[model samples]
Target: MTRYRTTDGKEDMKQKVHWFGAAAIPLAFMNGLFFGGYALRKIRQYWEGGPMD
Candidate 1:
């Protein structure tokens, strides 16, 4: 397999990765927070011997 090198392609890929990282960082953080809160809520319910909603 032969791969061609081009500055344009490299720059495009870099830009895409940069954009993805910018979006992904906050998204990942929010996802963690959402799940963490959900877990805590479930834990509290279990500790209280209440029904899970």
Candidate 2:
């Protein structure tokens, strides 16, 4: 047996962003930059046929 969730039209669906949520934008950006650089380095190594170390 499986249960399903149903939402009524009368349910409140408002969303609010707290002050801390705004701070995550910069953190997410920095994370993206860090990972992007790491990925680029790996890609360069692959192009050069070098071992991933």
Candidate 3:
């Protein structure tokens, strides 16, 4: 495993927090949509014996 070290620790953390904040919402939404669709497809497959792959 590799460790990432930054000279400006506080600034680095702040920047990382900002990036995460900006990305979290869309990422969460997309993940939810993708998993929801996947679950629905799986349910359909289980009930109707539809092809899932």
Compared with the true structure, model 2 gives a TM-score of 0.55
- Writing each residue's lDDT as its tens digit, candidate 1 over 24-44 gives 879999999999999999999
Candidates arranged by lDDT, highest first: 2, 3, 1
Q: In model 1, what lDDT does residue 25 have?
A: 79
The local lDDT score (0 to 100) that residue 19 gets in candidate 3 is: 69
lDDT of 2 by residue, 1-53 (tens): 22333486453445455556677889899999999999999999999899767
Q: Which digits, one per residue and each the tens of the lDDT, describe model 3 over residues 1-53?
A: 22344776533333233566678899999999999999998998999886857
Instruction: List where candidate 3 sits over 4 angstroms from the true fold.
Output: 1-17
Give TM-scores for every candidate, taking all chains together and pairing residue i with residue i: 0.60, 0.55, 0.60
For model 2 the local lDDT of residue 40 reads: 93
For candidate 3, the lDDT comes to 0.73
Better of 1 and 2 by TM-score: 1
lDDT of all predictions: 0.73, 0.75, 0.73
